[model samples]
Target chain A: MDRAVFFISDHTGITAEALGRSLLSQFPDFRFERTTLPFVDTEVKLRAACQRIQASQRDSGQAPLVFSSLANAGLRTLLMASGAVVFDVFEGHIERLETALGLQSAQAVGRAHGFHAQGRERIEALKFALDTDDGLRADAYGAADIILVGVSRSGKTPACLYLSLQYGVAAANYPLAEEELERVELPRTLRAWRDKLFGLTLAPERLHLLREERRPGSRYAALPQCRREIQAAAALFQTAGIPCLDTSNMSVEEIATTVLHRSALKRLRW
Target chain B: MDRAVFFISDHTGITAEALGRSLLSQFPDFRFERTTLPFVDTEVKLRAACQRIQASQRDSGQAPLVFSSLANAGLRTLLMASGAVVFDVFEGHIERLETALGLQSAQAVGRAHGFHAQGRERIEALKFALDTDDGLRADAYGAADIILVGVSRSGKTPACLYLSLQYGVAAANYPLAEEELERVELPRTLRAWRDKLFGLTLAPERLHLLREERRPGSRYAALPQCRREIQAAAALFQTAGIPCLDTSNMSVEEIATTVLHRSALKRLRW
Candidate 1:
């Protein structure tokens, strides 16, 4: 039987969902029907959420699991009365934080995703990522905090976007073209920015599958071509003393975090 | 004095950082010095993190606050002994989840950001977003889950990127060009997909500043021009019966979440 899970929050529900999903991933035995209720600050919305939880409980014949980060005390109290097993994400920690800091929490709503200077930085970084995507403007590499280089379809674009969006990092990517792959040395345009370059490489089989999805039955998607490109990229990374990550088993989040860790680049906080 | 805050995890520390940041936002009185230690699954790394935390405590004259989602029991125990005020993100919740579902957790590490089907979906969505960005490929609108229509620099590209990266939503964006803004009606190309269109508008002052950052001293950056284009876009949204959001005060996260909520689009779970 599939268990019902609800992520409730006063704002965008992103934090709640992220933490809740992490917890749920540990429990692989059960299938979950998940729902996210964001912007649930007001009493009216709280009541609506209560009704939804009640419905889920009635239908499933079990109290649904509710993970919430409601900052408002009243709405949180009301939610607890909804006959669901609620896990307040901030309950145990907020009081402890207050005690540790010797201060009171403002308990404000929707401060997590508010527009601020960090937001502007993220927008600018995103623009930089798009502008320099696929090595379109190598001249802009001077301003990039980090540049990702890899064979085509080797997970450069998504990693760059994740770094920009999540941490406000100015990340640009250059896709190694066929001509560049045929050579053993770093591309001339990338040599000057070698300090900022991070390489992404994947298994030849995985690369073949990825390229095949884009263009099946083509020489570009052939396994031999994928193997040759991967070999050349790895050799280039070794010769240039550039750090490279194998991205076959890693998601963009993992890849981006690994890059930051290996490169010792601090994630800029907004 | 700023308190040190550590986000520790066995995988990417994104979940820990997100939830910790949200909790800390409530206590706006004190400044926090934050560090993230991800992929800390080994005993060596755990010892290193403890050293960092102990160093922070010694430097700050107070124990640091550690927020962790370490899945391994031994490492988690080691983390608890680090002498910091540890808030294990899954400590209290995982047991409850096991009892609730009558199953034990897999207790795996790095499950949150593993390369999976959803990761592939997200990469595909990102490619679609880039391919169709700024009305480059209007014909590709047929494949988009949602099409964002807005004036230039009104938060279209970032929102589309967020929707794709976070939710695997194939979002495409079209900038309302100067000629299209002059008529006050939906563009002829957009007329076909009006149902999937979501409009984004911002305050004229904000729009003017944004445009000025891109192209200084241009007529497009003038306040009057900004106001005129905004008015025309607003009138066109009304004429086309499309829902619109004022993005002056919202982040891309907020904008993407609201679009999902308003459009009744379910965030795809892998």
Candidate 2:
């Protein structure tokens, strides 16, 4: 039987989902039926959520788990009395935070994902990322916070976009073509910004599989071609003293974070 | 004086940052010096983080707040003894979850952002988003989970990319060109996928300002042009009975979540 879990929030519910999912990942043996209820800031919505939670509890004969990041104390109180196992995500920590800072919490709803000046910066970063994607505008590399260098399908585009959208980092990616890989030195266009460069490599088998999905039975997706490109790319990274990550078994989030860490680049927005 | 806050995790530190930022947003009056320490899985790295926290406490004469999601119990215990205000993100909730499920946690490290089968799905979704971005491939609409329709610079691309990267939802976006907006009807290609259409609109002034940044003094960036396009787009959405959201004051996360909520689409990955 799968347990029912709800992630409730007054805003976009992204934080609640993230926190709940991270905790639940610890218990991988159990299956969970998960739902996210965002923008639940009003009394009317609270009542509706309570009914759904209670019904789930009755249907399963088990108390449904509720993970909430409701900044409103009154709504959180109402939720706690709804016959569910409610975990107040902000409850235990806010008091400690207040004590530590010698101030009271504002308890405002929708503050986490609301519009702000930084939002515009994030948009600009996203534009920069798209405009510079796939080595389109290498001249714009002067303005980039970090530039990702990798062979095609080495997980560069997704990592660049994730870094930009999530942290407002101006990230651009350049794909090393076969001609560039055949040479022993870094591409001339990237030499000026070597300090801002980070490399991504993947296992040859994985690279071949990824390329095969896009271009089946083509020379580009051949195992030998992938192996040669990867070997050459690795040698280039070693020669250039560029820090690299093997993204064979990593997600976009992991690759982005590793790039930020290795390059010592600060996220423009949090 | 600004207080120091650390988001520590054995993995990417993204969950800790999200949870910490949400809690910190409650105290907007206070300025925070934030740092993220990711992949702190070893005792040596844990010791280094403790030193940074302790240094901040000593310098500011205030206990630095540490938001940690370290899955290893021993590392967490050591973090607690570091003489800072440590908020163990998973402690109070994990015990309750254990009690409810009658199972002990796996206590694994890097489980949240590690590679899994769903990671591949997310990558494929990202590729779909880019391939169909800005009406590049209308033929691909049949395969998308959702298609976002909006005028240029009305916040479609970022929303589509975020939806694809974060939730593994194959979101394709179509920019409503001047000809299509003037016609005051759905684009001919989009008629086949009306059920998957979601609309995004922005304030005319905001739209004009965004366009002006790209092409100064152009007719496309004029306020009258923006107003005309917006009014036509709104009427088209209304006549087509498609749900619309004004994205003038919303972030990309908010836009993506609202689209998922209004469309009743399930996130392919958590």
What lDDT score goes with residue B132 in model 1?
94
* Model 1: DockQ vs. true structure: 0.65
Each prediction's TM-score against the native? 0.97, 0.98
Superposed Cα deviation of residue A248, candidate 1 (Å):
0.7
Best by TM-score: 2
- Worst 10-residue stretch by lDDT in candidate 2 chain A? A111-120
Q: A46-81, model 1: which lDDT tens digit per residue?
A: 999999999999988999999999988888889989
Q: So what's the TM-score on candidate 1?
A: 0.97
Per-residue lDDT tens digits of candidate 2, residues A1-270?
Answer: 589999889988888888888888878877789988899999999999999999999899999999998998899999999989888888678888888888998888886732455787888898999999999899899899999999999999999999888889999999999999999699999999999899999999999998999899999999999999999999999999989999998888888998888788986545
Q: Fnat for model 2?
A: 0.66
